[model samples]
Target: MTKPLPPRNDRHKSSGGFSLIELMIAITLGLMIMTGLVTIFVKNSQARTEIERNNRQLESGRYAMNLLTEDLRMAGYFSSFNPDELVISVNAPPLGPNSAPVTPAMTARPDPCDTTVANLNNTYFFHVQGYDYPYTSAALPTCISDVRTGSDVLVIRRLATCVAGPTLEAGCDALPNGAPYFQASNCFQATELARNTGSRLDYLSHFVLNTDITLATLRTISCLTSFGAPAPAADYRRYLTHIYFVANNNVGSDGIPTLKRAELGAGGYTIVPLVEGIETIQFEYGIGNTANSAKIDAYTADPNTYNACASTACLLNWLHTYSVKVNLLARNVEQSPGWTDNKVYALGLKADGSANVFPASGTYGDRYKRHAYNAVVRLDNPSGRVTP
Candidate 1:
């Protein structure tokens, strides 16, 4: 054997060619490329998640706002009473037996006070006996003036400059015959008194005479004092009314499970659920007039006093209107894509609760890689109307 000819030196040289420094450089470059690709993928995913969350928030806000607008616009609107005032009823006598009778006929008179048989001391009165108009025909209109369902005999009352009193003697009393009412006005051949059976009072408790009704009962009644024997010296004060909207607050850690129905009269206002992921809602009121540019202000518990110019008188001084601003904040409770990084957004809202500036943002979160939104909205139905 020629002794393997001293292993080829060329083979050894080939194996030793690559230096440590060159190997290190190659490895570093590969790692850098891999790192860049991973970062790009993460950012893209986060962005997509945020967009979806935002869309959901926007949709929910819009729907809620629309419903609120329609209802609020219809405030104070009734078919019978003028657009400015609404007529309602009371329970007890005006002041007392000597004070005023406040029967159905006396209170339900159409205008503040009409002299004719069809007319009475205003179309409103105070009848403790309650009004009992028979639904003789199915064709009868649904509502009687502002009062609809419920007890028929109520103390009729009105809100106006012309009509006056909680007095039973001149206005509230339906009749001096000790029957159950006093007359105020007459329209054409219309008579204020009705000749029903005496014993039927209990059975007829829920009935009302042929009367007018409109869209919703007047929320308040004011027993005004007057100089002309309850005529109009001291003006009629007001009662309060309010409405609340909410989802089925019954949502659990699992999620919202049911729909909520609106409750008509007043009672325990059901707590409503906001959007599934929404955390809060902020509101702003325009201190200026509806027609002009408004100066947005922080929301107050009592919007009327703050934005409505301090007092009822000042509030009503406007052209009968003001504007509203709203802000909605939504969150990804699930952080679906693990994109909970914080991002602050500055945005504006329209009358219908839609964000106009859209995805505005400020740096946020530990990674400084998240985004958020701030919205400002305007309310269209602000009538600058006094809460009274």
Candidate 2:
């Protein structure tokens, strides 16, 4: 009696709807495909993030290097001083229309092994009461603290040195080429006070160190009475062999970060920020011929021409240095994750074996990246020669 099922349809002969097995299989395949896609997407995102980070670090490093190199190139270039080393002194005598009838004092000297040796006395050297906290307000884009004064400036000077110790020495007198100095300590110093005879810049001078020292507090010894005296008069009236460039770190009332510069006197500091994020600086001296470069491993307190006399000599003779090697360390103030390893970027490596490394070879001192750079900066900008 039961009704017989209709004859199977042609469609039914084919795959019909799906069997449970088929349905399960299809679902499994779709899930597997989705998992693979998601994994690819995640991996891609991570890779992109890492790539971006590396690129940023590389760019930051290059930018910092460019800034530092440019300033280093101009190390001792001054419009006033025809030859950079003939820097005006604390009591540097004014030159007549012609740089003649040289002051007997600057050229006075003791005999040297070489007859051609210039007089040490006649060499005019600049002195600084103390270096400015920030040599120039224009150097910085933004400032966090007020311009440091007096002891604070001296503290920075003391902290900055080739090596550490409390005693103020000739080495601590000024920050190497680009460091800072304080006020009270700077002006009150025996040399600064000694050199600061009259309001005129003749006696007062700014101090410059031959090497880079850490900036915290400065230790200073007046120019020697003679070349070898342990301590010289504050003014260096007794004797002064050479003057070094002093660089300063400071913030101005205008809220600009800057590096202070004082060229003994006539040439007051003109702030030029070699680079931003530069918390400190160090230097390695370079000397030798064009064929092969040589770095003076030992720190030389003075690089002025070794003229033995006390009075008149050509400042240019001492300015004969042709090359220099500059080392710079910059820090990012913004808190951010730093790189895991030292990176060598393809873009910045020069043809020479030398390569500029990024993130330095240490844990980030800050949460953000801190990069250090070392470059053999040619002092002569026009000609690629190493300057002393």
Candidate 3:
């Protein structure tokens, strides 16, 4: 009787959940899948980051090159006026004493044949000069604080393309107090400097123009005559000076190198950051044999050799320069993790096709990647007009 349990329902066995081994196996498979996905995601993210960094570097490099090239092309431009014939006469009867004539020949100084070239002012009539390895304090006292060591400096002087019309014209209204102003043939306006209280304007401030297609003279108007009549169309422009160099750092102590430009501004030269991650810059000049043939003959990296001159006759050698070889070393914005940059980078021409390594001294031992950009920029303005 005790065994008389309801007939054991063979079809309805006790139901239970998964076994311990099955649960463990499912968990293990899930964990493996999750780990693989995570790995894929991390790798993809890292790759994207690297790609973006490289793109940024390339874009910055291109921008730096374009800026330099554009400025170089416009160097020494003075409209249709001949810079060699420029003779600045600072004469002001009201100022009492007349300044001695300032000719291009007077601006020539004996070439010191050293890094001191960077300290020299813009003297050449066709104002274009460079300093090789101009980072030393003695060479660039004004810019040494920001300049990167072992880098070249380039200077360019020219006239602005735009022209201003007479101050009395419609669009060229004179400033307050009957101050003298300038106006180009196209009716552009340029106000006179109020701070330039001196009766005679500085020779550097005057803009020489080819007004009648036959004569070129400094455009000047007296304040008394500013409202009398419209001045003849002045086809000339304003003077411009630009200096370019590489800075050791850009923001704080981040040590991010940058390409900086110093441009003539209202308050004098103003420093501006052009491109970031430019570690070093080098320049080589190709001097043309103007005496024999107007063709480039030699390339030199030393400013002293390129500007070698004992007198005005020798100074003419600088005008023979036809082209500039620009070499820029650009670096990554951020440091790469667990990476080393130990390779020697060639900048330009070498004796045995070697040397010219970057970091010139000790190994960087840094995690930053670098690349070299080389470009040969032809100087159209200088090459076109050669001094006899």
Candidate 4:
């Protein structure tokens, strides 16, 4: 205790803390490392954002193409009934009295939005109808609005491939209410089976294709054979009519171009937005010189105009369509930083750098990137049927 107070001042001086210059140098190095880390993080974030944008554009484009292909392939698919066998029926809904037999025929073009049984009957002739931009009609259909002026509109009509119930595609009916349905008869009358003239009117008399599924008169098996017992209920499929086109906006002026469809539902035509960022859609039809032939004789954008006849009695131009070439332009959802998109997207036609009707200038002078998708899809249901 006597000498503890006089501790060595020289020892304390030898173990002194860092000098001010050394401390400043360490701070500068730390700051440099931190700045490098920050720069790396920022670059990574930007790259990730760009990748996300690109993925969305690609996925949207692919999904839209698949959707169109699926529906187009099924066009004119009326379950057991062949549309080719449907001859001119004066007893069609429009011509005859209200008690007309429900045979398939078209007095006029069937409106895609029209869910009425009368117009539904008209699907026999109007399957796979398409109207290019500069539509032959003065205006677009009443139910479809905000259709991108330059984009194409395609109408696909068919019955659901599966039975209408809680499961299966196209139908999606837990309990069918007022939705249109198509049912085929499993039982054939002796008179019908014997003649086999293959006439549609005679054949359709055994089936029911109506908007009401709750009709009690529908029968799958012969009720006459049941003899006061219950007859088996025929499986019902929802009737699907789709008008697909591109819209200028996805929501309230969100500025996102989208692929949309007017679906024939219980409440008439329900407009539904499909894939977004689909800026344009176009189509080229491959028509055959002969009816129900697979060989393509001519290709045109306006099928009706290309294959017009002196009389309206001939087959509709759309009905002769055997293949369809689809073209879609998909744009990125977000603008890239300091990016300039001056690319010409050739959706269809010759790639001579010609100006397209979609962009009007052939090139999109914007910050968002765009890609074009194309497919030549065969209309299987219509093309596969070889009239014997």
Best by lDDT: 4
**What is the alpha-carbon lDDT for the whole of candidate 2?**
0.34
TM-score of each: 0.34, 0.37, 0.71, 0.82
Model 1 root-mean-square deviation: 19.4
How do the residues 151-244 of candidate 1 rate in per-residue lDDT, one tens digit apiece? 1111222222122222323333221221112212111111211212322112111122112222111121221224422222121111112222
Q: Spell out the clash pairs found in candidate 4.
A: none
**Runs with alpha carbons beyond 4 Å of true place in candidate 2:** 1-15, 79-91, 94-280, 285-324, 329-372, 381-388
Give per-candidate clash totals: 65, 77, 5, 0
Residue 251 lDDT (model 2): 40
How do all the candidates rank in terms of TM-score, highest first? 4, 3, 2, 1
lDDT ranking, best first: 4, 3, 2, 1
Model 3 C-alpha lDDT per residue in residues 282-324, reported as the tens digit of each score: 7777777545344888777753445454543333445556687
Summing lDDT over every window of 10 consecutive residues in candidate 4, give the lowest-scoring window.
87-96
lDDT of 1 at 222: 27
The C-alpha RMSD of each candidate to the native structure, in angstroms, is: 19.4, 18.3, 9.2, 5.8
Every candidate's lDDT: 0.31, 0.34, 0.59, 0.71
